[model samples]
Target: MTMTAYLQTMERGDLDSWGTPEDIGSETVEGAPECAGSFDLGSPDDPVFGGLYSVTKGKYRVTYGFHEHATLLDGEVALTNEATGETVVYGPGDSWIIAKGTPVLWDIRSDVARKSYLAVTTDIPA
Candidate 1:
């Protein structure tokens, strides 16, 4: 298959809702948080995918099932790597990478937080 290379501008704003926190394997630990995303590159059958994700103010816990590199587009957040017990505060323009199986505790410190991400997975649904 011929895949065209493209550039996408990720804006920090409303996006299509993927679902509640549970839909994306996250458990809400505090205040209600709305989650949304836009998968702009690759399919679920592909090994790589890229997209924008956003969540409202709250605290949540989630485990990464795939490797991902992400950049914060807007807002502020404190991410705690549960396994390492290390925490990092991120704001607009911050970036990081998360390996598969890494558990994270997300503390949304702003009204909302938005990020653009590229993820890789070995398993593809049939």
Candidate 2:
């Protein structure tokens, strides 16, 4: 197998780096976390992209506009589906997916949480 154009090599980037943790938007949720992430690949320019992202311990709600799959690289958390009230817990080594237009609640139960994720967006986020 070979790496493709979708691949990225990550390093510590300035606050202005694309997809860096600093690029954030808000929607309901709970507790504001002191967040940080260094981008490794992709950007708002691509139809599909990914990078490293993290959040401090806190309860929050997230709405997914794009299809995304992620691995829980660190920490423990609970995810609750908004429409069904179904909840699942995830810890290190766990992988999960959030479909486009779904809403989820993230209950971060560790000091910090991290994940590596890939997102496919039909409509790019600005």
Candidate 3:
């Protein structure tokens, strides 16, 4: 789907249909003193081919490296895009349509918490 279409779908909450349980990776950045997690969306063969994430506790600043589906179900956060130098704040019920190939930095101003649905890309075996 096109980017605009994806954004519109997310805004309308249609993207929720694409969510399912996923395995998330977490780590605490030194000095940041926060815990974070990333869910891995299986493959296209899966029923829900996307990642769902949640910050059960703590606060942190995140750097966005790749384009993926993200939603702010609760709490608050600030995101800065290095390419455009644009910063945006997200709170409950807010969502972000991150463009592909863009780099972003996130500052979890508040006790950072969120849930996201991300599309997974697959690799073909040689």
Top of the candidates by TM-score: 1
Best-to-worst order by TM-score is 1, 2, 3
- In order of appearance, the predictions have TM-scores of 0.85, 0.74, 0.53
Q: Rate the local accuracy (lDDT) of all candidates.
A: 0.84, 0.69, 0.49
lDDT of 3 by residue, 1-126 (tens): 533222323532322222211221223332243333443555445533454444433333334334456777656777677687899988866877764455555556565455556652433233
Clashes of 1: 0
Looking at model 1, residue 103 earns an lDDT score of 96
Error of 1 at 14 (Å): 3.0
lDDT of 2 by residue, 48-119 (tens): 887766777777666786788888777788889887899999987888988887878878889877777888
The collision pairs in model 1 are none
lDDT of 3 at 115: 55
lDDT measured at residue 109 in model 2 versus the true structure, 0 to 100: 82
Which lDDT value does model 3 have at 47?
A: 38
